[model samples]
Target chain A: MDDNLMNKLAILAEGAKYDVSCSSSGVERLNNGKGIGNARGWGICHTWSADGRCVSLLKLLMTNSCVYDCSYCVNRLSNDVPRASMSPEEIAMLTMEFYRRNYIEGLFLSSAIEKTPDDTMEKMYRTLDLLRNVHQYNGYIHIKAIPGASSDLIRNCGYLADRMSVNIELPSRESLKLLAPQKSFEKIMPPIENIRNNILLYKDERKSFKKTPKFVPGGQSTQVIIGATPDTDRSILSVSEKLYSDYGLKRVYYSAYMPVNEGPNLPSLFSAPPLLREHRLYQADWLLRFYDFSVKELFAGNSSSIDSNLDPKLNWALNNLHLFPVEINKAPLEMLIRVPGIGHISASRIIRERRVNFLDFERLKKTGCVFLKAKYFVTCKGKYDGESLDSEFIRRKLLNKMDYQQISFLG
Target chain B: MMDYLYDGTFEGLLTCLYYNFAKIKATGIYRTDTYQTSLVNPHVAITTKEQLADKMYEKIRKHLGTYTLTDLYYCFLSEKDGFENILLSFIDLCFRNGPVYAGYHTHKEVIPFDDIVGKVKREVQRYVGYVRFKAVGDVLYSEINPEFFILPMLASHFADRYFNEKIIIHDAGRSLALISKDGKHFIMPYTETDLPGSEKEDHITNLWKEYFQHIAIEGRINLKLQRNFVPLKYRKDLVEFSKPK
Candidate 1:
């Protein structure tokens, strides 16, 4: 019996690996003494896989069997791969055992459609229900909202899960039609919209009635496959920005498309994945979320992609050099963070340190700001540390410090 | 220059701080166990006094706030060579210049103090996830080999997490263990013995090893990046990194 379960686990985990949304953050739940686990607001990663991605949750699928055929998916109906499904009891047992041993933070449960969309959704819901109610597990759970599932079933799953996400697999509608022909914006967008509305309503209700159950307290997120289509970085980031502003998303994961099945519409199987481009997109995503940069600000000119050599923030600094040399001692928090090397942590540290003492060049270095890059952009106590304020000279100096060899396709 | 020696404990270090403030100024502070004899300087053995240490603790908390006190405690836990002198000088600077000096990250005395504290805190965070347990009868047992004395820091996090399970987290490097059961937890000195050999292979452990390998994308196999997060030192205790016998 155990051998059978292990085989199913290996198959289901392989099927779910491509979805790439394993974060267990944005929720803080304490174990109620009788339960087995609790969650921290800033999540913990149990271990990292060989690919260097954080294994914060036990990422697995309910079943590898599917009805729909998406060309990019390994578990699509037409693919000849090992097929298996785990009973809800088996999934709950594995999650509890792994979580008890500290092998994972929680369960990241997603599934390919075994039959209809509702059938897959119901099985996922049952697994969450068993873990939550039967096993009394209080750890983090991130579940996927299968597109075209019934609204009531999705709502029930949201209450048991910490986070819910609907994967907008392809960025553009045109790509969606050509690649994942069965899926569309019409099926994908509604569940995300419903989740956003319900999260707001539940939060407001909890304010009035403290006993009201939390509905997806970690908020919702989505993933988009990059390099699968010709979608520009501008368009991709704009979609993320709109999701943040409109849907109030917690995060938007961008997975570089890995060619699994050979198809006319897909990239050639032998071609390398666009790892560098994906890294650049993630950098821009961080700027949008924390550094107060807009999608428009990232791509200022006719260029459709972010600069390959420099990071988005440094690239932005090079384009808008007139804004520098920002005085470290007197610049506001907003302007200070925009400096090339000063991150949100260092920017706030500078603010606090300046309140007690006047920051000089030596003092600024001690605040943990990256002096190699920030020296060209920021002036400490009105002293310019760089040789010249010219953008070209500064860019050349900054590029020299970066290790260009690490920017290969495999990286 | 006078060298003061005390028992290696946070309370003992605080008493040394009390002596520096109220009694006599010392050039060097050393833990009693790790102190080396010096012909040039006269040594003073400062016994750990609960009253004196409590007074200094209250003074630091009242003036410097709880956060600064916590940082000082973390630094003491690091048990690094010459950390006692660094802590003394940092406390002296903070007291002389008021509480604002604690936030002076660029200051000479604050820099080394913050660095030691950061290492200790980071180790605590890493162990929170890296700790892997195996069921031995009713108790869940795990072992860790960390550079610093971080068992005290990890106590509350695991106690709240595994409140219902009888868990023992053994720190083999320091001969300490955090034992939690019945909704309460405490740290004490413990020595471990080898478990009796079981003929049967554990199925769950095998399943976790399989899942770890299957999760990584075959095309994006970067052992360099993997080692960056899970360093060579930590791989010994991790279940997935261990080769199956």
Candidate 2:
């Protein structure tokens, strides 16, 4: 609560806000009756910031001082911002106090490279060590894995933290070279690969030995800045697809590039961040992860970017109109989910409820499906609610509804 | 048809249901405190019988299963107007058609019951994040004004998480508090005057406000979006939303 700590918290939080990976989910930890905290598998958002982002953790940096001059980063060495660092003791103390007051689920510890990668990673490791051992904090802890840090240091921190991430920064190696000459896929990929392999190794060991400590039990994730360079949505999503399949990541966060620093290589400071593009990428990413859609399916044709006017699922449905007018009562679960507005939850509910009684148009609405959208693609009990099977008509209707909603929202 | 009135408790409601099944068909069930006199319909005052309530509880569990029973309990906690009539018809339908009737999501009787239960569960989940604790001496204290009687539902989550710390989550609307200390917890009647005034700011809260302000991006200032997530109704007790004196 001192002035020095308050100033450091303000500066460091500002530096870490752009990282945009504030999830505390994927681990269900219980307090041992002696510990002070627990982790819910479904993460809890303590509050929302003015930017509408969830404040799940006390997101902070170990220090704002940097040696690498990444053009996209506000904490680059060339920037003239206030620099402050928190000691391991200070970080641990703050995390405990905030967590005990229920202000946060846990701590999200990230840092700009100070002195060296190993030095920065070591300081972060000590903070986790003190929180987990000395304080017996059983809460969630997500720490950033420094890209160029030694594997030993990364593995040590892995055992103490619930989740870890290494930012891919740019979509492609070419963009990385242009914007951040010091950082590359070569430096970032190794830590991600190492964390993935160690997670598997630790899980297998835990089955054999119950006392084996968890190595990033919440799994590893990575982030890529959107619209930083000339990276297309296709390239970004392909990188994400590779990370999910090859590296076995839990999430791939796509951060809209906010131009905090002025550089010849970066976008203009006056240009708005491509927030809608980032949202479309997230929608496409969900389709890839949960909806069984491939990157090839999302970008089926010559289009290299996602449709900005509609969601990826709806766009895919519109493109593949030959598959529409699906029989709601007879369609398989997989086929049912492919229908627009029918999510996995509603699709399963339809399967379950239909087993007891045949579903009618009225019954399908109660199953939690968005009838307005699904009516265009599905028929219930041989009754089609849509006026026609024309995709153009449906698209216009949906777009008009969306425009109305947006106008009301602005008003 | 006669109206039945009983104490405002889950067991009392079950007892009223038992009486309706045993003696005569009732037009509706009303809580003793909230019951209004009607000129046309005769009313019967049903006494609370724990044994009869237990019998009805076991009957519901045996016939409709624990899932429906849990939903019914949550619906009772919602305290919505005309909820007793909704639950009565829902139970009547379940008894006639067996447990499968509960799965009839589109049924007229089941729809309102599900809506009320869903609202109660959503409020409990929201309060899990919205409850703000303050350090009142050695004990941590928080006050929440929830729409449902959700204090009992929130007991295990806070008790399990803060097992070592003394904590009290007060439901100011219901005048009840969930108090936990040293791995044990209980819900008891508590009033606002029991705790000191919480307007005084501490340095830790000041530090949190500072961090909250600095965490938002300057370029993407979206107060409307923020209001959508943390609505104005919930800002009454949040530390970051409070203005400094």
TM-score of chain A in every predicted structure: 0.97, 0.97
Q: How well does model 1 score by local distance difference test?
A: 0.89
Candidate 2 docking classification: medium
TM-score of chain B of 1: 0.96
Q: Model 2, B24: alpha-carbon shift in Å?
A: 3.5
Task: List, residue by residue over B107-207, the lDDT tens digit for candidate 2.
Answer: 88888988899889988878888888988878999988888898878888999999899999988888898999987899999986466544333778888
Model 1 quality (TM-score): 0.97
Measured with C-alpha atoms, the lDDT of residue A289 in candidate 1 is: 96
| Per-residue C-alpha lDDT of model 1 across residues A269-368, encoded as one tens digit per residue | 9988888889889999999999899988888787888887888999998888889899888899999989988999999989888868899888888788
What lDDT would candidate 2 get against the real structure? Answer: 0.89
lDDT of 2 by residue, A121-207 (tens): 999999999998999999999999998899999999999999999999898989999989998888988999999999999989989
Which regions of candidate 2 fall more than 4 Å away from where they truly are? A406-411, B192-201
- Using Cα atoms with residue i matched to residue i, what is each candidate's TM-score against the true structure? 0.97, 0.96
